[model samples]
Target: MFQLLIVDDEASVVDSLADTLPWHEIGISTVFKAYSGSEALELLKTNTIDIMMTDIRMPGLNGLELLALVRREWKRIKCILLSGHAEFSYAQQAIQHDAHEYLLKPISDGEVLDKVGNLVGILQRERDESRHYERVEKAFQEHLPKLQGDLLADLLQGVKISPERLGQKLESLKIAIPAEGRFALMLFRLEDRFAELDFYSLSLMEYAVVNMAEELFEDDFRLWSCKDLHGYLVFLVTIAGEGDTQQDRQEHPDRAAEPVESRLQSMASQLQLSVDRFLKGSVSVLISRWGSFPLDIKRLYEDILLSMRKQVGNQSGLLIYASDELEQLPVHALQRLYEPPMLVHLLESGDWEKTHDKLTGIWSELGAKWADSQEHLLEAFFSIYASFSSFAHKNGRQLTDMIGPHLSDVTGLTPSRSLEALQQWMFQSLELLQQCMENETRNDRENTVRRIKLFVQKHLVEDVSLQAIADYMYMHPVHVSRIFKLETGENLSDFVLRLKMEQAAFLLADPSLKNYEVALQLGYQNPNYFIKVFKKYYSLTPQEFRQKLEAVEEQ
Candidate 1:
């Protein structure tokens, strides 16, 4: 809804304009009138006006004065001036005042409506843009935490993060942690008491644990936490700085690192206590020793994870704290498996080009970095193989149907399976699956277009609109139009029109049929409109076309 003000000195002029003009059609929900500039100013103050149309000359304060005041007070309200005097000076003043338009007196209703209609369009566009921005801003705010958590997950999973990139993401996500600092990894696992909880209940437990961890550690550490793919609650806790600068840290590295490790161990013990007391769930905590942020965090995760797995063997409510020992964790660079341009995302989107590129990058990275680790190679193979299997299942097909029974025995493959054998198997499987998907899509499209063509042929003398065809096919008009053009190389409307013209030509060749009868038979009620369309298509009137056809037949 929008408000407009019509200000003129003459009451009759204002009344006639308001009463006759279709204000609602132009999206002006309310029209306010004023016989004087003072009254207009008072109305402007009282209402939220979107546009103001004012006479240039009025009693007491004039239109130009009112325009200036409105521009100052209500900057968003658009203004237009009206006057009998079409003087250059007055137009210049109107332009200077930022009046949207200046129309002379005795303006036609069409001109006024056109000007106001254009302004209404502008207002609607402005409102839409504002709403779009606000929605985007709100969505970003809502997802800020998830985004920050994802970044942390990427870094902890050995995805390379440059210093500048890290700083930019930290700032964008509004995380207070410094990009270059001492940090540690913590892995928490809920014990057997809550192991029987459903997915939703487990999610609630994870949230409660994270909230409690934040409350306990936020004072001393900039904490980021998320449930990793392996179902462990992982935290990349950056140690807050002491009252010392980088140079001071260079002079006393142990002083900055050792105290934080001790404090984190104490905090982890207390976190376990809080979980047991309030949450009624016991959690085992694995705390890594302090390491440099981002660069050391991934290695720290690998080391602590391995340690926890080895030491905590079937134990619960235990704290497996890391020592000062730094193990050289192998660089898998397998983090690309979980990141963007990933095989799953590409496969889900059915983007063959990007999917091919992603598969190539994965194999290339494996050959360059993890070729020696047969275990890592097997892991990558299974990950991609599982994705393809899932893709096949979703399409109501089987991997064996696409590539034979060898792929179904993927779990039986050992680390001893040669890399070349695995790569060949994967490439062949993928190519076959891609071809199948493409064939299925093409067949589906051809079938839809075939149905639509039949529908149009049957309804040529009826309503052959795109929407009508879509309704018959039980599809959306946009989908019907797009696939029709893609499959037939012609617009849906053009196809319908061509069919109608063919029917018209057939009917016109019958000497017994009158022009109006032919028009009505082909679903055109107006003979003139039918003749005009026929001329546009055939370069002759219907009568001329019939005479030419008869002469040709006689010859």
Candidate 2:
């Protein structure tokens, strides 16, 4: 809340001004009054005032003196001086001391209100900009620490986060959970509508979505949301009371599962329809089965993410992760099918022996952990997808692209046939992913060289700044400077100067051009400055250099 102060020696004028304006509606918390500048100074010392209104003709320590003091003490406070046009000199003095505006006396409450409203709007905008900057600065500060946390780690590893930090961040986000409960995850994502809602508005909408989801669950259950770090609303619901009881089944089990499931399913369907209808947006949702909890939240999150692999590019509907819904497969056998990036990284830099060692180490670790016909096969698949999906996504391919459409066509005999089909599918997917990774790596290297050459060549004739190069490449100027030094073994400024000097040498040899014309062509406004640079480069002034070249040509 912003405080507003009104100062006038006339009791009637001060009283009317203070009472007439609806302070709270205009976002002012308190209105202070002072008959003299002495009284106003006392009020200012004790209170936080955002705006001050004073009449220049106050009996003692008048508006001009108060404005001076305000500039010295409360320099941040905006001042509006009240004086008649006849006392225009006092208004002029007030402006010199940083008075916000000089208003004519006997002003109506309507005029007073309008000025105050405009001031408040300006103040509000300034405060909001500060807050947004604070958020961005805070995010950067916490980025590394948060990267060590479960969410990013799991997303990168294609596995779940550790249990502790999952609960911590969830609680911090104001999502409630019951002890020793079961949970199901539902991912609600708005496609291409991220920029439509700003941060604060999106935060509120996510809270509203969570509250609506909580309503569908019983009183025992509590729902919490972990926002999509990549982009979506991830909801975790803790099923209260006992487990999915037989009593629940006896009381029409399908209907029991049906209500909460159906509502979420309906939300998924209706949300997409509504987004398209109202916001020109689209949505997709992926739901998880009632996974046992006090159970790992990270695993549950991973399951939801894996369900998205099945979603592909579709806009609407819900996919539930269930034991029955999962095709029985040899996920454990396939787990060894793809080596993670650690081994891949060793391969990337042409560290052939280290790559071989890392590959062997990964297989050795997997050989002991993965056994034939592992019971929690789908859970293993979830972990694998969770680890790699984010990598695929960050580099531009969705999980669906990695897995391929063959995933949809396969279904067969109980465990073996399903396992072999899935095994082949996952292997094929990994192969496609490996190729994608290789292509991206090569492209990045090629692009880096291309961007550097383009940046240098584009600014060849001009005295290009590091900032200009960085802007052209869409990167930090310091980073561009550092990269230029690293790749070319010369500072950016030095490189550009050398290139320009070499070009200038060629231009100086052209007898048709005058020194100033050559300077202009070489991007120097001052010909004398160009001569100095030319002297530094060739150890001769432009005239001396041209004389030598002419002597050599004549000889």
Candidate 3:
């Protein structure tokens, strides 16, 4: 439905049109009558007028002038001019002012309905097109992150694409990095503290890290990031523009004095500190040297991975930069041992089969490449030992509890003495650890649910929010919600409401305590709202419920 405004200098003409015309039949739900052009303008300002029919020879602000002003302000409104004369000059002025129809003052109601109906059809078509475009835009925005991530991941993995296709993809994905721009790579590995998180929590932490990077680097660089195949977050960064750099220099004199590499190093250090302080986790950062984009991306990724494996060691929160002058490690640095889906991550995820395969692959590589290198054997031994020990401690146990005293007691070089002995110990320890974890999974969930219930009951009148419960349990709120729902077959929020309502019913049984007093006891600030909730829960108002109780007791 649309709105229509009828204007004329004569009051009778405006009233006749507004009252006698079947405007509703032509989809005009509202017909506004005005005696002068100025009154029509006032109506247009206050209401959304879709079609305007005005007399051409009004006293002030004539029809053509009004049409011109409406054209400037509300371009979508369709205007029709009414005149007593059929002069060509009047028609020419109507056409010049973009009027939809130039009708004589004694025009028929049928003609008016026909013209207004046509304008309504045009408006409906435009509205449909606009809604369709809005939906498409919304869907594209929702999937834009995944689209950008897929393109970046493909480029980093060296998928073959012509420059034209790559450029098209970049433009469509709205990536600001130039196709041939000079860029550098930054690789991040979440340390042991992050690795202990469940898969969902870990993904959220990775997202947080990326968001932090965007904030810290957005001033000087365009950053594109994705989680690579090796379970590491990779950021492809390029300088935004020379203007931005100059502006940054003028804004921060202290930072401007340092070289680009030094500034980046400082920012990376800040990122590490932020993660540790806010997220309660540590991350190891590796920044690669600058190289040409597209051509050097794959090489830089590989170099950074190699550097991380050789230099990161078992340390937590170490930041290293790739430099040409850095010392090269030994030729055989145990590639498969530090490869994607590392043993620790697999164990943390409880993928025992993959963990077993990972161990076998590491031993196979050790035998093929560095059979006689005792240092390599010990390196593998300690790495595997630390992963197992960390997993045990994470579950509130010790390595000795899972693998028995014999293996735990062997201090120095005993376990890594031979390939056969190390393999035996590794397999045996993996079997025992898998058994322990499987047995403990159910018990762990049950215990977590029990603790959550106790905490909610204790703080039933206090904050009992999800975050408060998670803090008390030393868990993420999402993790806590998931665990409670999985074990109890009910949402935590529903459970809390059920408890509150049940307690409200119990308190309502006491006549000495008023409804407001009971609401306060249950942490509800509004007694009326409490009554509404009680009625919703028990199918009766509190007063009625008390009456029923009294009747039952008298009976």
lDDT of each: 0.81, 0.63, 0.83
Give candidate 2 regions above 4 Å deviation.
1-130, 133-158, 178-213, 216-218, 225-235, 239-366, 369-486, 489-493, 501-525, 528-555
State the lDDT of candidate 3 residue by residue for 1-555, as single tens digits. 989888887654664567556778878898876766766776688679888988889898888899999999998898889999989999998888899888885777788788889988887887777776887889998999888988888877766679899889888889877666788898889987788889999999999999998998876667888999878899888865544566666776654556777777888899999989889989999999988868888778778877887888788799999764332545646766776667889999989999999999989988888877888888999999999999999888989999899877667668798787788889999999998887788899999999999989988987676556777999866678889999999978678879988898899899999999998999877676677667867889989998999999999
What TM-score fits each model? 0.64, 0.34, 0.37
Give per-residue lDDT, candidate 3, residue 72: 93
After superposition, which runs of candidate 1 have C-alpha atoms over 4 Å from their true positions?
1-132, 154-168, 177-180, 196-205, 242-258, 323-345, 365-390, 398-401, 404-417, 505-515, 526-555
Best-first order by TM-score: 1, 3, 2
Please, what are the lDDT tens digits per residue for candidate 2 over residues 1-555?
Answer: 798988887644664577446788888887876666876886688679999999888776988888899999987788898887566577578769988778887797778888888888888887877775887778856763343334433443344335686678546544455445556766777666644799897766665555555564544355455565566776655545435467865665444555665655655565456556755655666767765554544455655665676544454443444332233433523433342445334333545455445434443444456434444344444444454566566657776675565542324422223344435444455566666666766676457646876767776655354445665778755566666676667766677778778888899889999999998887777686678677866789989999999999999
lDDT for residue 96 in candidate 2, whole number 0-100: 90
Better of 2 and 3 by TM-score: 3
Worst 10 residues of 1 by lDDT: 324-333
Measured by TM-score, the strongest candidate is: 1
lDDT of 3: 0.83
Query: What is the alpha-carbon lDDT of model 1 when measured against the actual structure?
Result: 0.81
Write out the backbone clash pairs for model 2: 157-387, 158-386, 158-387
